[model samples]
Target: MLVVTTACNLDCAYCYEGGGNGQGEMMDLDTALRALDLVAASNQPFHVQLTGGEPLLAGELVFRILEYIRNNNLPATTAIQTNGVLLDHQTARRLHSFGTAVGVSVDGLPAIQEQLRGQGAATWKALAMLDSERVPFSVTTVLSSRNTRDLSTLGMALHSMPAASAIGLDLLVQKGSAAAKIGVQPPDAVTIRSGVTRLLATLDVLNAQRSRPLILRERQTVLKALGRDEARPYCQACTGSSLAVTPRGELYPCTQTLGDARFHLGTLDHPRLSGTALPDGRLPKREECAGCGLQGRCPGDCPSRLHYNGADGAGLVCALYRTICDYCLYKGEIPS
Candidate 1:
């Protein structure tokens, strides 16, 4: 995931990239080119996640990077995670032509969304434009206290969006600034389970009448989580395997680890010195993982649940994990 630039226009309360306060020279074209070159040389396939404080805030740089990919014919599936507020007609056209999938960070309805994003109708305007242009996109709702009670309501709203293909529910973000700024906390396990249940229930109702209900990717992921044996590194958090390149050419295993010098793998010019980045951060292979009766074929991936207990996630999350699996399976979202 190339963190193209960290300079976002929105000052989201939960702005994880230090409120976009430290874009730090804002990723020069040279740095971006060199990073792309390195990826091309790897002879490996990757989906380039264009992220930012708000990537559209750096529109020119984004276009140039896309142009580079087209010119070189890089075997990369590209997508941009944008706030959608800045997705004007021209920008939307360029993105469609570039074959870049758009992921919008919209929390919920106007009052609910404005409470967190502070942009209100402007964000929705972008969503509308995408629909008008017939641009394919998805909605990423950061489920917060403001919208938690209305999970089903939010799901229904997303259902009405014209060009949106899926709904991504990030019930909460990190615990630092977002919590303090928005007066929000990560929903507890019980709260999370309830929200998912509510969301699935919403989908159930939709699928009942509509021949094709919109997909909730998180539900499918949770089912996969219920069946796991061996440990794989969490999605983009794995060292070296999944990477986030900073604007200044520095590298991190995941975008969440950006700004912290500890996870700073290295800069593009000196990537060989990234050995210190991992520092034995692998998930522990515990007895719970090894001895569980339905292990490998059950609860797949949950770095958050595991990290909730710190290094002792296996011991801490066992009962809660089982309860979730039971609940989801009973709902028939997961096949028996």
Candidate 2:
């Protein structure tokens, strides 16, 4: 992942980047190119995710990087993670032309969106623009105490967008503005389980009516883990296969660990692509999870969140995965 810039246009209540206010650094063309070269050196099929406080804030730099990928014929699949407020018609067209996958951060309906992201109408407009331009995109919602009850409503709204292909539920991380704020806390386990249960039922009904099903990112992960012989790491960062490059060319295991000198790998000038030596690089065995029914069936939670929330983090993850896996078993969605 490449954090093109930390300058965000919105002051989201739970922004993990600490509510960026357009006063952060932007990546230079040379640094971005060098980062791409570093990834290419791995000699592996890799995915490049262009993310930021709001990547569209640096529109020119983003387009240039996309152009570089195409012109060089780099062996990489690219995507952009945006807040969707700046995804106007021209931006949507440009993204379509580049054939880059787009993931938009939108918390739920208009009211919830306004409360969390401080922009609702613009996100709706961006969704319309993406649909109009035939840009298939996914929605990522930061599940928090604020919007846990509204998951079903969000699912219905997303079903209306023809270009919407998936919905990814990101449990709120206790960092940034979220940690400083009073009301912005991760939802309790019961709220998550109930909210996700309703969401799963809603999606089931929605998928039955549509020719192309709307994928649930968490459910997909659980399904894959269930089919595997043993549990796999939750994300590429756990195995040290992924790196997040900041605008200043600093590298970390992933975006969530972008700062924190402990996880910092190195700078673009002198790269240190060590595997699993970083603090959160390797997945640690949790004694608390031993002998749990869902132990092996679960892929585990985010290392960054675990590091931040400690024991409470594991409880949240267990609630989420257990709810989804139990729902699937009850519905016979997969063999028990």
Candidate 3:
């Protein structure tokens, strides 16, 4: 994940990047190029994720990176995670032309979005623009007390967007603005289980009726676990397979662990990226998770989340996965 810039245009209530108030630095062209070189040296199929406070905020830099990837024919698949408020027609066209997959952060339905991220109308318009341009994209919602009850409704809304191929539910990490006294929090285990149940049911029915199914990212993980597939790394950061570069070219295991010294590999000029050890140099094992039915099938929660929420964090995710796996067993027909 290349954090093109720490600056962002939005002040989301749950922004883990310290509200991305545009006070952060931007990545210069040299830093971005060096990061790409590191990626190329891996000699494996790589996924370059361009992210930031809002990557489009540094539009010129983003385009330059994209152009570099294209001109050099780098062996990499690219994507950009944006809030979608700045996804105008021209920006959308440029992104599509570059074959860059897009992931938009939207809390939920308009009202819920407005309450959390603000600029509900702008984000909605961006989704419409993506659909109009036929740009395939996915929606990522930060599940919290604020939007847990409306997961099904959010699914239904995304169901109408032809270009929306999936919805990824990310638990609220209690850091940055979310760590504030009045900040958003992850829903309780019960709320997550219930919300996930409704969401799975909604997606099951929706998939049964559509030629192109809207995938629930977490549900897919549950399905893979149920099938007893070999457990893959929870994320690039989990196994230290990917390096996240900050605006100033500092490197970490992944985007979520950007600032912590423990996860810091080194700077772009003197990278310390090596080995397969996790960012913390240890696999997170929880006593509570011992002997759970999901066990190895579930790769576990994000380390950064576990760090923020401690042992308590696992329960919420555990409830979610267990509900999905149990639901599939009960239905006897896992929805595609």
Whole-structure CA lDDT of model 3: 0.82
Cα error of candidate 2 at position 193, Å: 1.1
Ranking, TM-score, top scorer first: 2, 3, 1
Which sections of candidate 3 miss by over 4 Å? 229-232, 279-293, 334-336
Worst 10 residues of 2 by lDDT: 275-284
TM-score head-to-head 2 vs 3, winner: 2
Whichever of 1 and 2 has more lDDT, that candidate is 2
Candidate 3's residue-wise lDDT over 222-294, tens digit each? 7776677455666666666777899888988777777878778889888887742463322345564575556
lDDT of each: 0.68, 0.83, 0.82
**Ranking of predictions according to lDDT:** 2, 3, 1
Which pairs in model 3 have colliding backbones? none
Clashing pairs in 2: none
Compare the candidates by TM-score and give the number of the best one.
2
Please say which candidate is ahead in TM-score: 1 or 2: 2
lDDT of 2 by residue, 1-336 (tens): 889999998889877767867688899899899999988887878888999979998989999999998998888888999989888888888888988999999898888888888788888888888988879999999989989888999999889887899999887777777778566888998999899999999999998888789899999877776777677666777777888899999988878876777778888887787643334312345664574445655778778877766677677877787788888777876634
